[model samples]
Target: MKKIIFILSFLFGFTSLYSQKLSSNNSKAIKNFNEAIKLYENYNYLDAINKFKKAINIDPLFIEAYILTAQVYSDLNMFDSSIVYYKKTVEIDQDFFPNAYMFIAKFSYMTGKYEEAVKYQELYYNHYKLNPTQRARAKIDLNIYYDALELYKNPVPFKPINLGPNINSIYSEYSPALTIDDSTIIFTRKVPVKDKAMEQEDFYQSKKLPNGNWELAMPLLGELNTPNNEGAHTISADGKILYFTACNRSDGQGSCDIYRSYKIGNTWTKAENVKELNSVSWDSQPTLSADGKTIYFASARNGNMDIYVAHMQKNAKWSHPQPLPDNINTARSELTPFIHPDGKTLFFASDGHGGMGGYDIFYTKKINDTLWTTPQNIGYPINTHKDDAFLFVNASGKYAFFASEIENGYGAYDIYMFEFPKNIITTPVTYFKGIVVDIDDNKPIIHAIAELFSLKDASIAGKAITDIDGSFLLPLPAGEIYALNISAKNYLFYSEHIELIEAYDSLDPFVKYIYLRPIKKDQIMVLNNILFDFDQATLKPESYVELEKLYNFLVDNPNLVIEIGGHTDSIGTKDYNLILSEKRAKAVYDYLISRNINPQRLRYKGYGDTMPIADNSTEEGRKLNRRTEIKILYNN
Candidate 1:
């Protein structure tokens, strides 16, 4: 079988297996064999095949000629034909070639003959003495055959849809990345140059139109893509940072090093080589987390290509990389890692752990933020007896994209997307994203920070800073209520709690167009995220984060004094509502006083149900009415 990424000399090169065994008792066969060997040495595979066939026709029992013919076929990548010829040699005399059994077992498994492949493997093991490496390989092969047989018996749905011509080209395209909203997609495409013999890999981008169709893809504009190759990249969730592979560059610390770029206004800055991430060995295929704090990549450092993860520290320096657990890496190689935005399900291609065939895609979920669970094969049709790598699961967990080099694709390799079954999905993710604009002129506020917190625990779940266009995106899981806070330098902070119910396949994204009012006197803003105990003066623990924002605001603008107004819904008597609202306002007032603010600058009021913003008719209206608000009292 072909090793997918790198070339292994032992798998492709010939072993000197005593070439004089059948050097013919007949002079005719002897001449043909000598000529065939000469042609094979010159790399003339077609003519060598003919010469080997001539010798086989003369002496049908010539085991040496049969072995040479099979080697030529394997070199040509006609693996089925090679297997047939190898089997013919073994059938003539079971002990004719000792390595024939192993080669036949390998090719048979590649062709999906699992039972026969296992049979041949066991036969080779029992009849011949084994070396340490070869014996371990045989054991792995046996396990792989059983896995193939088991998965083939009960196949999952793997009907992949070809991403149409708008994304794919007459050349090759692969390694897809997308933001949480799925509006833009970035991938690597290799197109032929006008006069160059070799095709260079370049990044391309496409956006989904309002009509829900992808636009024509074009080359990505950045200094990252030059005459040299740049590919195998991952885009952060906000679509502002990019991490990719660049080889043989002047600034590279190794043969291939990982590089990163920051997007500044629809244009990317010059890439910088991540010096701490690279070593003296080949390193590439980077997958960065949504928050850009964690990264995983494939490296050939510990004598084999294995997956290693590195973490970015609070000081903005990356720590040393550590290899993944033994369950994921093997004596063989693993490559093409895709860590889902949810940060738990990791999909990667591997040949080390036993699977159906070459580099099958497997996924494992993270237990906590710590160790990962054991790897499991995705399924049969999704993972065939061929190389499958570079899989991407969109944030919604609806579909996946990967590259395949098959006869039916556009060219040497093409990107294909498959809609996963509901059960096969990664963790469900919902998004809340849009542009933050100035209410005065509707211009984007480019420096806004958005924070999301779990309503249950009052702990922050995620956060994002707006990009150049004042656009922010945050990924959240379903079945939870999250409180959000958006703030800027001179604007009133926006606060609200969003609810997302759990549903596996159907997710509706929340698109918010936030308009912020500038800091001015008499401007009233509701702190919707603040909470209080029922019918009591005590502030709930969840109100601390929001109150801290208010305290900080007071400290920043010392001349500004404000009134904390409390209101209630029309659910109780007028006297009860009035008392409850007063106590709640004082609860906030005392908390601020304890924080050492000037007490003379603060005042409290209870509007009760008199200043209701909504009708208080439905439950949703009642939710809106029960809120704490702040108004600018004096600016002097």
Candidate 2:
């Protein structure tokens, strides 16, 4: 009997210990085969292969010689040659090596022979009864082979353009995070450590030029980059706050922990460990919601890697991390979760979910706060047998950025962008970007808070603070009405409605140059969000959102007395409009009093159609005329 060994991947292995009668009776062939085993064990693959060939040539029916030769080729990663020798063994004796079929299937799939891979996988199952794990893997491989075949026939349009030399280098680059406007990009680059044989990960950034080219990338400016490893991060929509992963630092709660940094006036503050969101297990690869209130990341706290989410609390601390639903996280590993700016679709990479193979990118839609639709594979060539991960789609849902090693890439894992496939794009998102200036002085209002409220439940959809330049940006998901309120100390809060419920160009965003009025007498501000039923004094349910804002404003400035004035369109009689407007104004006044505002501080009046901000001759003008306003009466 001749001993033969064939080592496949860690998932499978095979060895021949059969007691069948010798197929080769030649003494010279037997001697050559024995000598070949020594060279193979010493890792002299080519020499061993030559000796195995001599044995096969001397005795054409030598099954052992053919099997060993095939194993050598397989170990050398020469799948084509391995397949040839393995097939020779099969031809020489069909029952000699049953495991040969599985190897053939694996190598065939590796070499892009999907149809052949499927055939051999099916043949392997017919010949052998596998253990549970092997059986599971066999089924997954079959699904992958079949899916790959179909995908090859009908490929999605994918032309990945490299981000160019300015943003890439001769070292690995990945984990790209972009600002809402796509004007700035920050990513991780792995560079060789001086005087060391290892690489270190650090943050790098580049700004998009007016001509659409990227400026030369430089190490991100701040104390955020340290001697320790830092990578796998996400940026807030405004590009002011950055959340990233750092490992083995003294402050880390886990082997890898998430940290945060702030970009203030082109200089990033020192990173601080986000201890509330960290566990005593390895955690990395964070993605944040557009609001910067919710976060998703990969953690190995439960043994196998899974995606976990945490929310920012009202007290400005992170909530305890919770694992995502089982549909998104399987017993197998999942990683690189990216929540789109729309805040409805979540993209991640999972090996547990059956797909082409390895970690395939999958997307699941957020149905609500606690539920998500079952994940769907983003589909074929975009996800191949290799571990494809770290995908990011822009707000317009037209282009995606990822990192991959290409034939002519600058180096390992260079960043690339591709036109997002239409079939898999999430709902397009738009952002509200503007500067908040003092209405009187025209100076930027720094550190002002902007809160966006959803009209459906009046929930805080997003929040941002104005930069030193008085600029702010926040994402708006499609097809929803939003109320934006911007406020600063000793200043009347700015309020407006953003109606995106109807279809419009999502790429064209809302740009408002907000002017915050100073708190003084005669400073009148329209309450655009306050609404009433047609031809009636009853306030609509949606009106309570603005009413709450009024109550809070009054509470914040206890000594201020204001008049809630209402007006109506010109179609009605003056008496009818005046009476209806008076009741509407009283509705706001009574509601504030009900919420603890002193009645002495409140007054109500109706100006009928006397104060028309626009032409009441047209419907648009009439709509603008039918509004409520807050007029400052006293500030003592």
Candidate 3:
């Protein structure tokens, strides 16, 4: 009763026939047509195409031969040849017009001729009311075409309606695999099935109806539906076979193994565990490339869950799984890898590096046939503090589908849809810009420490020092929130929060201005905040945490340095105050010493309050005046 995942595809079948009676006049035509069928069955579609043309030439009205030839040319990806023969078939026999229209619609859709495809599909439906099954399938494909049209022509806001009780239960259900034609949807459902004492998860599927709703779901009964967990599946592009994950059992190679099932007639044959894939650890979340030649998935056998890929051999056996390079997988988890339909981009979830949260969606592009560039964060709005994974983008690469925990969502994790900004979706770039200044004067303040914190985790993402003109620029992947902190001594710390939500195709400057206030004695301040230790000439461990503010102030104004002086009230003997204050002043001097401040740039004196701003009679006044003070000795 393990969860059995079924990946289904929609397929339409047509019949082929040679000339019924071999009359002397049709003998050469029959011979050519028979040879063409043999070549078509063997998948020598291009060669079979020429023979079919010869047959049609011998008998100008060989309609069935024309239909078969068009199908073969379509399979060979020669859409122009396919369209010619299909049109010719209908010209010879008007009764075959609906079938011809269907082929033309499909070819048009494949070639991105949406308007033409829609026109032809509508014609097919109007001329011939197909059987219940054909109509059901046709409606689903029509819906897909319409969806594709909406995705391309308009930037329609996405409103994801929850599947509700009919499709979702307390159990899990996800990872939908659709046929290229979109007539059928196969998704994984985890449902508890009872078998004597034990209960386990099992896979079930529902078919689309002519009315656009789904039919009642039922289990896929076959050898593939085993008593062990079998979920996470993918189907080949042509819709002939399914590749899925099956857990370790008496028949499995390891903890979880990849398996495949071939379609025969109307049912799937016995499942065959892919012996070439499984290792001792774990391997799952399989995805097949659109061409059906490459398979990508997650595996922990090489240590953590990293993405790996395999190739389909000429004989249809899979090669050994090869781990993706370091650019894609670090010594951390990388899962739910998806190879987009475009075949150049790969999207996956990783915690390795350069991310906003624990797990964020990342992508890498194949610069050429063999080279993959560095991975990049997809960015905010689409990514959040919570996990954002399991991504799928359509052929046009406009809208994308992923899971998120949006407010009022249907479940703990509900599927959400989003669009990449038109510019970034087309072309992408990196780099950020901003400005810093003094709060009181409103003048630019250079050399302020600007630390960037990731809003996803509130961790320090990066740091940059403002330049001479009080401007800073940093490189960042588009789509994120960052906290910028600017601080300098004798100045109030400045903070600016920025969110880069919009996608950009080229370098876009994020104009920002920061203001910092001057620090003075009347201003309430945290003392240990400035760091000084007890009974010691050496600065405390925590000293620089605050003193760095002073250091930065000096760095910002190279011609400026103040006298580091310490004062004390009458609590101690005047001699003791004089000597202790000298030590305290020197401590500040030495601490700045360790920081590479030139001795020529600093000086120290112990006044012991020969000049006291507050009365020593009160404890508060004594505390205030018996303190450290820095006066600007020089300013340029």
lDDT scores in order: 0.82, 0.87, 0.64
lDDT of model 2 at position 617: 91
Q: Show the lowest summed lDDT stretch of 10 residues, model 1.
A: 1-10
Clashes of each: 0, 0, 8
- Give the top-scoring candidate (TM-score): 2
TM-score of 1: 0.88
- State in Å the error of residue 235, model 1: 1.3
Question: Using lDDT as the measure, which candidate wins?
Answer: 2
Model 2 residue pairs with clashes: none
Quote model 2's TM-score: 0.92
Tens-place lDDT digits, model 1, residues 314-430:
688799998888888888899988888776789889987667788799988878655888988888878877887888988778888777775677677777777865664546887
Candidate 2 RMSD to the correct structure? 3.0
What root-mean-square deviation over C-alphas does model 3 reach?
24.2
RMSD of each: 4.4, 3.0, 24.2
Q: Model 1: which residue pairs collide?
A: none
Error of 2 at 65 (Å): 3.4
Which whole-number lDDT from 0 to 100 does residue 168 have in model 1? 84
